[model samples]
Target: MKPHTIKYAFWGAAFGICFPLIATFFELWMSDVSLSIANVIHAHSTQPLLWIIDSAPFILGIVASFAGKKQDKLQELNTHQESIIREKTESLQKRNMILENEIELRKRISVELEAAKIEADSARQAEEKFLANMSHEIRTPLNGIVGFTRLMLDTEIDDQQQEYLQSVMRTSNHLVAIINDILELSKIKAGQIDFEMRPICSNEFFAGVMNTLILAGKDKGLSMNVSLHTSLPEAFIGDTTRLSQVLLNLINNAIKFTSKGSVTLSARMFDADFGTRLRLEVQDTGIGIPADKLESIFNDFQQAESSTTRLYGGTGLGLTISKKIIELLGGKIGVDSTLGEGSVFWVEIPCAACDRPESHAEVIRNQAEPKSLNAKILLAEDNEMNRLLAKSVFEKWTQDVEIDYAFNGKEAIEMLMEKDYDIILMDLQMPEMDGFTATRFIRTEMEAPKRDIPIIALTADVMSVERKKAFAVGMNRYITKPFKPEELISEICLCIERA
Candidate 1:
């Protein structure tokens, strides 16, 4: 104990000691007062001892005073001992309470840690499943690139020439976008993406996305729109590059599913309590998800759980990646819909993006003057007649356009690396390296602007799914097989414009 506390304890003991002494003194004082009041006289003449009779009272007072002092001292000692015991008891109680609180905190922490582990495990499993599905998805397309490019190398075709070559180039570009998405997704997840955060021009971004998909939309006869809320803060800090892709996915989904009416995209600020929040909504007057299927639509590798998989074919990763991107931006995603009526999917995020810079391409450049083929072209095709047919079309389009040969996707990539070409017309289906993989590598590996080289898809049917798929993979345009000169001319013009 500190000296001051011990001193206080001693004082308390002294007070306890003085209790008996004070009581005894009071009794003696009362007796003396009563004697004086009574005026009692002792027989003093009987004996000299009697004359000293008041001595008895004085003696009693002395005895009482000494006895009281002794008793007080003993009581002080007892009180001091009791105080020591009390202090020890309190110290132990406090220690016990502290220990109990610590144990409880530890228990709570343990429970929380276990729950976190379980969640992490589930996430890992989901990632594994997605990765597995994605790899197969990737490899399946690669075969076409390799197979078709190889075929062209061995075959010699000389007919309807140009049409077939267009298929190989178009399909290759589509494959590349798939690979690019895979790479970007990895980089973003690994925190290796050098995201340039800036205040993005919302209007410009919206317009650019629209322009990029315009041709595809036209092919499907779908109307597209972008409406921004006036309340929006004009611009916000964000990675526009990524935001564009997410918006593209949403819009493309709208276009693909909605057969009639239109696909509209809008943005508004969602009033939140603490921080800034904005909602990006994509509404499609297409095939709305059923009440039960709404939740599953965002799941990877799923498409409304129908057997008509081939009817509306897709790898089903777009929504999943979009969700991931939104989450990375610290946002929440949800959809509201009714069967047949329509559906609206929205991604709400905190408004914290930097200012945007001027976009790279204002408007796609199209072929200004259509002329005959004169330059050498690497024609990667599987069908010999298709290869010959594409060459003739290219030669016919421009006297300067030349043609080289690759039967499959792998050979096409090799040919692209070997020499330069004014344009490439890609086929969708082939063995080995597919059109998509080849196109992806060329665009991604090539420097910006040069990556803008025209790649047209030569497919059999120009369905909504096929068109979206072609654009998603970076195809300039998807021109169906047995295409007319007028149709091909328009596509060629658009391609040149984009360039």
Candidate 2:
């Protein structure tokens, strides 16, 4: 079979032959009867016996040689297998090392990323604090400017002086609007805006919005048209104030851009799983936005054209605020425009059908109507000019009502302790003790009438979070500064009546 096997066979045959000769010699040497080697070799008893003995030696030798060869081959195979196993182990160890290094690198990267995020968050918080302080500082002096201007406007004055005062008021209002936009954008970014859901009549809401915006439309020689779908629901539940805000922005934009032709306000409702989906649109025949710029126009501080900012004066935050407000109300807003023809801005809001008639304006109208409260009231304001403005307005609005003033929250608290006032107009940012602390003390520490006395927050901090904080600290109502005289009177009356 194999060369080694053949060699083993040959060796076995030689051994077989040698073993007999050697045995014959040994037998002749040891035996007394066998004197010659020939006689010893021929001394077998039978032919079969001689053949068996001879074959047995050759077969045993062959088998032993084959067994030894097999063991050698098996040892060689085991050695090769061990080498392969060692090589594979070395390869696996190298791969594991690479993997361990990569894992460590990723861990370091993750740690660095987390540190960066923490630093970014810290910087953002610092920026918000700075803005809040700036808003307070700016609005404080602004209240004096707007308040004194209004007071001067009310007094007897020459036509030229009156016109100048009115211009000042308009400029002040513009500045206030810009500040409001910045603050409102900050609120949206901070997720501090909350929507109040209530019943609304689409028709009445549209009418009110049109009434407020028509003068601008008329001034631009543009006709205002309203088209309401007959199938639209009479009453639906949604955030009326936010909806109004969105419509005001759209309509104001329409009026601001249009040189001639008409601005159309329209509404329709569609069936939805939630009950009804209302779509409101403001279409204008104006200098339309370019197709590519439609989406960008809604971004903060963006306009349809760069030149639009120079031509039309605005903070450019209207659409951004409107979009955010619509989104918060569970809606989407979009615009379609032809660059030279016109633009149509639309919003879709999901609403629930309401069985009751819409009465959103009724409560406010009734509460805000000119009326005699004939109740004692205290106005706590730190600014002297704002203080006089409030006094004059309160006196002008209410009949036979005794009003008192306090310079700060501490003074307000002291005045409350001495007298039984029906309500206290609390200003938020005041010296010695802030409105929140004073309100807390009044509610928790004071007794009876003073403790339970209705307190309205009247301050220049118009941020929603600040308003929430004021309410959280026992303020009954909230009103921002540089407000309308009518609004302040309404709040005072409502608070007193509620108490």
Candidate 3:
């Protein structure tokens, strides 16, 4: 019926026929009969055992066919299993390649990001250094201009000359203010501004700020006033200097914009879970901001209109700086205005009521005339104009005060070694050696009293990093350039008294 069955059957039939014939021959030989075809046939017919042996071919063939069919089925199942295993292996290899590629991509992205961060840091550092150098260069000249103008104003000059000098002084002061604003914003960006929470008398603080700015408003023929709510606390903890700065900017802006109107500052307070929340408002009858531009006015170097810059002549950084300062003090600032009538700028800051009030006598003492100092002073400055300005200021303050000069920090140190001076006014940037190095050497290497002598940093660099470095090198006090003569004298008297 099948090829394998037929092949097995044929081989079995040949074996069966051959075996019977051979056995018959063996029997005939044993019986002594003649060996022939006829004899073999007769033997086969007579022997039943021979007939049974001949049927073996059919049984053996059937068993052989069944064995072959079982082997074929086993072979087919093995081939199918091998095909599945091959497909699974190829799929796994493809997935592994994809995973490796993704890992490589991630590593590349990480490296690129790290490189970008390093570049950004380097650029920021460079910008800070450049700004510091510019500040020093600009303030040095401004100091000479302001100091000499003040000295000239004190003398007996005619009205025309006096007016001209006053104008020059005003312009120079405006330049100084601009420089200060830029540096202040830079400090904010660098995260270097520090606020001190001290006890402040709300009434006294407002009075002081108004006193300084009221004259400006009067000169412009504008009415300026302050209205304080009875609910406001007499004493609270806040940073008076920063708050004053913001208020000053707002008031100044109002004065500059209004031609014939009044400016008013008001304050009130409400209770909060943290403490007292103070709401301060500056209302001005000035040219108001457009509705669309009100929100954007607080952005850095932004103005409501481009012509506003041309007419007002400001850098437009005032509102931006004020906003940043208020936010840093945990406050919010906003403005509301019409197109032409007026505007109100408001800020609300969190402050805690203080049990201890500030001393009234301290305020009185600061307002009083600066005390005269009779001491030998050493001033280390490289600029010729700055040296002359300092000498002129000292001559104006007191006759008994004796001042010595050093062109650089090295000369200052050498003079210190040779003479006994009461104090040293150190300039931060100098040739040959800087103030930090000189001060460090004085503090660490020099012996007793010379090292102990009071040192004040009189520098033009306004970067907070430079200020911190000055203190770290053992300087007693720091004052920036373009400073008021009265302020400098006051600082000198205090340092001398403390020493």
RMSD of each: 13.5, 4.2, 5.3
lDDT score, residue 350, model 3?
90
Give the alpha carbon lDDT tens digit for every residue of 142-260 in model 2: 87788778777888999999999999998989888888888878878878788888777767778888889898899888999889998777777887778888888899999889999
Order by TM-score, highest first = 2, 3, 1
**25, model 1: CA deviation in Å?**
30
TM-score of candidate 1 versus the correct structure, residues matched by position? 0.46
lDDT of 1 by residue, 1-499 (tens): 3343444445555555454444434444654643332322322233354334434444545455555666667777888988998898898888899889999999998999998888876785566445534544554444345334534533576654434655665566556455545644544554544445676777777778887886677688888777888876556777878788898988877777777777887887656786778788989888778889888877766677665256555567778778878888788888998888788999888885444455566553344454632344455567666665565555445665556788887887777666776667777666887777777776788764546678887654323344576688787777655455446556656565456
Candidate 3 lDDT by residue in tens digits, 446-489: 99899999999999998889999999999999999888888887
Model 3 score (lDDT): 0.87
Query: CA lDDT, every prediction?
Result: 0.66, 0.81, 0.87
TM-score winner among the candidates? 2
Error of 2 at 103 (Å): 3.8
Candidate 2 runs further than 4 Å off: 1-95, 271-277, 327-331, 349-361, 364-375, 395-407
| Native-to-model Cα distance after best TM-score fit, residue 426 in candidate 2, in Å | 1.8
Ranking by lDDT: 3, 2, 1
Task: Give one clash count per candidate, in the order shown.
Answer: 91, 0, 0
Q: How many backbone clashes does candidate 1 have?
A: 91
